[model samples]
Target: MLNTQIKYIDYISKVNDEIEKTNLPDKVIEKFQLKETIEAIEKVELLVPVIGAFSAGKSSLLNSFLGDKKLPEKITPETALATELRYSEDEHIEAVGANSDITTFSIDDIEEIKDRAKDFKYLRMYLKNENIKNIEPLILVDMPGFESPLDLHNQAIMEYINRGVHYIVLSSVEDGTITKSMRRQLENIQAYERGFSFFLSKTNLKPKEEVEEIKQQVQDQLEDYFDITNEIGLVDDNGGESLQRVLSKIDPEQLIKTIFLEDLKDNYFSIKEAINTSISASGKTKEENNRAIQQLQKALDETLQKKNNLIEETKSRYSDIRINAIVEAVSMDLSNSIEEIVSVGMSGDSNALSETILEIAKSSLIVNVKDSMNDISGEIVNDFSTGLSNLNSVMADFTISENWIAGIAETTKKMITGASNKLNTIVSERKKVQNNNEDIDKTYKAVTSVLAITTEVVNPIVEVAIVFLPEILSFVFAAIQENKQKEKIRTTILTTTIPSLKRNLRAKLPEMFNAQVNELISQIGEQFEEAIENKQASIENAQKEREEENRNMEQIIQTYKKADKAITTLANNTLYKE
Candidate 1:
């Protein structure tokens, strides 16, 4: 981890040193994002959220790590949950309100926090704990339990998951196998393109041999479901050593790299392109420069003219078959669980039935939408990247005018050494974003960007569940007669619940996802516009440098040579793969 940090910091420091000698424009310097990358390293935190059932020893695992200090447990309040633990010298606590306001409280005032827990979104504890400090940028969160009410906890957990946190899932060893609730949580995680480290708590309560059998069962279940990034560990009454081992498994170095590598590469490519374009444009005839500018203006203008078309097309493409299948699949999944729900109702667990069914509904829909919507949304954006590449192809043809025959453009003169050029590079203003790396990068951006906003697609279902579930449950229980046949009771519950789930699921599912789809389309358009604008600015800068008699041209080229050499030496030093 120290080495990774040092390497990036050194790389950025060297780039900054070169920037000082280079006479690049402020925009290009900002595009390099050297300072921003450093700041991001400081700001980036690995959120390790402990997610599990109501009495799943989540707090115990967290408390074990805290050692002397502990989270609010046993007496944790309803409609208010999830505690974020971070290290601070101040050693105080903060109450983040439901609407995100902050109120300060002393560590001893945890009782006060519990009294008004309903007023808080979650409690943020700043402690001087050694374990917390040892992890540095990793922040541990006791996320709301999987069985928490749909009105509150589901949305909260969903939001946190979208933030790209690693989850530590804890369940009681006594539970034998993965519970239905845990299964739903696991599915939700999988749908978000994430996996978790499973921990079995209260292991001390059971025999060692029994623990082994149960652990195997849980491990087998996870492997059956996923490709298994399982770091299955055991925690007991005392927060077991497995807590630290599981916590230690999250490599901050990898997280940091995953966060910034692609962007850093992007900046390098873009700045290099700008440098190339500047050098090439220095020799173009005023006639050739004007033609390029005209072509750029026409492209930009056409983008504006076609902005609505792009949005409609993306929304249309995503909505047609894929989203419908996902929504319908949610209904089918919920319907399949009808017997289980009927059994809950039949057993007279009326209070839990509604919440249980709600969990199934919300989880099924959340999983289905995330599984389909995120990928589809990503594919949609990658399509834009490809199309943008094609646009560059058109410009490629235009840039190949008489100026290229004389080899003024660097593309004509130089044999590029890298695997690819950027979509909106200054030099490769006429190149398409058709490379594998660029496609993957764009797809990553599309998925992550959509993820941040995709929670909107699931929130309506939760809102509907709040009002719909209790009412449907009431109808179901009322219709379920004491002397009724078992099949009749099942039919009663099914008729009552499935329609409600399907209707509500269908109602807002499409609308919400489509809304995000359109928003992503708009965002993709903005990125495209921004990229094209950069190209235009590069040309204008070239025209300015040309107008100025190219006095600094050689100096700029020297800086590029140094930068190019440095980049080549460290090209493969990054932690992320293509």
Candidate 2:
């Protein structure tokens, strides 16, 4: 069975070799490589590199797994350098330098290494212990934390991680929040062919309840912030055991077999077989070849159409999500502004009145300022979905077009290439323009200045209103006095005067006491107008971009149809000639 598997692998490998030599599409090459990698996993043992932030217990975890504190200079021991554990007949740790120079050292010698020896990028150590030797085909490498304060340490760690097949991400229990940088790193890793395991290290530092709480919080954060739903493991050294005990709890052998080995082997063999079949049947009779090509093209078109539809749907969903987020943010700001205005006005402290009014106006004006700016995020998602849908639809239609299915495939390849180039250009230009628009800073400064002025205008009025409370009362009394007959004066004063007094106090007090309030409102309105103007400009630019994209897509479609027609015409003419 092993021999047969090897023969099958070899045959697939040869087919891939031919495909690579030919100028096949990148997608085809990627699919071929994906298959080969899976097949190779069955024969070769996979090595995974474990990495994390500082104080994340990467070394401790490794030590626990090895059942010995032998992984030289474990993470917290002295931050000496990064260490790699591999299987070899001889047991020794060696530092390898830039020019492939290697120097042998004992675990204790790590402290003595200073300049050039310390400068070594990667440390390779062989396990001499009997227990470690029993574990087949897997090596655990402990790397320096990527976020180490030491620049050299970080650089060396990243270099090693770049070459790793799998990553074990260690995080702290106290602060389970992944920083933006860490999130980016994880996202990049996710894009590649690697398995990721998140470990909340040093669980013993906190109580069981606290640890569980932190885990839940981290899990929620990962889901909300990164959309990662994977189960995360929490390991603590303080759980009545040393590192060895903790390591024993985790079955590295099972982790390797289940996560990496089996699935990869299966995928590799399947891909290898597919590639071999495609290449072997590459050259057949013209009619037979054309028929196969047509089928493939039809399949491609249909796939493209399906993908396009999915993209459109996703775009719509994401657009809604984005718009809702914006609307909620703006609404909250507006509510807060109104609340602040009310609070400050009612405080009855004249001196602080202007400052409060100004703050309210400023807050209210800035709420929708960002909305005015042309945000292409929504449109980009929409267009991306549309483009995908169009491609898929074209592919689906082409699948049934026996006359020019092959030509449709060629046309799609060209269209995708062109679209990719155009997308890159558009993105680059948009970024440049946005970077150049330092007007946001200027607008912010202007708004701040206007808010200050608005406060200055309102403060005095608020103070006067508060101080002349009796005079304001007299004015209401006078108005009520004018409306009443002598007999009804007491009744009028009791029933109508107090209510009118309250009403006038509520209405006229804001205007009379907070005179600067109106000025502040005007300033806020101006700022809002400015923001709207800026956003309008952005909207115009976005609309222009959208129109251009639509035109380009239309042209591409027309070109494709023309090519299809020409191919059909030729095919028909050739049939008649034959």
Candidate 3:
């Protein structure tokens, strides 16, 4: 029943009130980055990516929504890419490159854009049209049809499904029903647990009676295919209903669950875990408390030692594995492009050769090194998972690493009495559904933030390879003879250029990888430290109360109980349920 993102903001505000109950200086709110999470929730926009089969008028439908032939395409763009239409007073297109480079294009540079389409990651077109402004947070992604060529286009679609709250899929009315290709796309959407609407475009090209029959047949097929009885929103381009109007009908609670829910639940569980730890530590005698504190201190000490070892291991991994992979990939790819490299080498354009080598290095890094970093990230989590076992049950286990697996396991034993009871009521239904549907792709807080920063591991490593090019390849072009030049050029590249690239990479890359790995582990380990400190704070606070004979332990315990009850009731509401 919650119809706006305001419900989520209000929910967070209420949770903050509970977080304030404990007198710990560093609260659960700061540990989980809830303030930033709320801001991201407020700025959440529903991306409606429209996909369909060839000539399904996917682009036409979106440009029509603009009420102008704004997006230039032959119904669908020729390339396997997306053109994202967003609202901005200052209108322009930013061509995002695979290497995260941006090139700005004029709003009217349609031909120029088409010429350079293959070079772009996606085109982010900012528009100031009235209808676009009216939709507010709903941005439309114009996607390629089912039969589009190239792997990057498919990758783009796959990435979009992760962030898209829902999809608006279209097929032509003339086709009369869904095609096999479209059915596959819908299956994929279902696999990702995303909801989509069906729109039959170009209805004006068919008879009204025939359009009605096709719409009905498509609706029935979708229900039968997806094995669900929920009615899909079907619209036509001939004007009976508008796409914007149907998009407005999207259930806001579903949107919240899809976009902001994982982050919200993260903070919820984090606070619950902290409270439980405090309660568990409450009844311990002074000697028991000292023993526990000593144990905690021992773990913290072990963490510092582990961090130094991990940093050293990260440096070795990059030098041994990541750098070697790049060297081999760049060398192997260039070996095949001997003729092209020879051309650039003979033309005396050291800059062209540098550019060619840089492209190959970038490709190699994206395909190879990025994944290796994720593996290292997984190792970091697994290494610390055991050491921080007491505090991680609710928070650390689920901390974001692309390759790590998160499971609730037996860590629920850490919860205190009342919080455990409340968790039981929600876990049987709500948690299971959310984990199955939405939490599969989630990355928790600073872990993900650090990863985002480290994803640029490619640029510094590969771009650094460029500087060595001019220095190393400068000698090959000094003397050119037609008879021996080609072989000399190839040998020089395979011998001199590549080794220089590898040497410089090995020299500079381990440090880069170390910094990233350190930041990631530290970000995760800092949370562990805070949780330990909060528990210690709770134990000490209770001691002070007993010494003064003024503080009521039952009252403090009741505050936590009340917080658990409120959180449980909120989870039981319609927004958190399936």
Cα deviation of 153, candidate 3, in Å: 2.1
The C-alpha stretches of model 3 lying farther than 4 A from their native spots are 1-3, 14-21, 27-29, 75-80, 230-240, 261-266, 279-283, 294-578
lDDT of 2 by residue, 1-578 (tens): 23324433544454455444432334334533435333443444435667666667777777767667775433332344666777667777788876557889766665555334445767887776654555444455676664432333433533543345556777878675775445545654443324566778888788899888878877887788657787777787732133333234455444433333332343333333333323323323334434444544444454445444544454243334433443344334434444343343344433233333222222322222222111322232233233333333333322333323232233222222121121222333345456677653222211122222222323332334333434433433454346533334334333443344344334432332123323222333332232223222322322333345334534433433443344334324422223
For each candidate in the order shown, give its overall lDDT on alpha carbons.
Answer: 0.65, 0.44, 0.61
Question: Tens-digit lDDT track for model 3 on 314-419?
Answer: 6565446766675577667667666767776777765556655655554555545545655655556556666566543332222332211132211211221011
lDDT score at residue 77, model 2, on the 0-100 scale: 23
Q: What TM-score, over all chains together, does every model reach?
A: 0.84, 0.39, 0.57
Model 2 segments more than 4 A misplaced? 1-45, 72-79, 113-117, 130-135, 147-151, 191-193, 238-578
Q: Lowest summed-lDDT stretch of 10 residues in model 1?
A: 412-421
TM-score of 3: 0.57
Ranking by lDDT: 1, 3, 2
Residue 526, model 2, lDDT:
36
Query: Whose TM-score is greatest here?
Result: 1
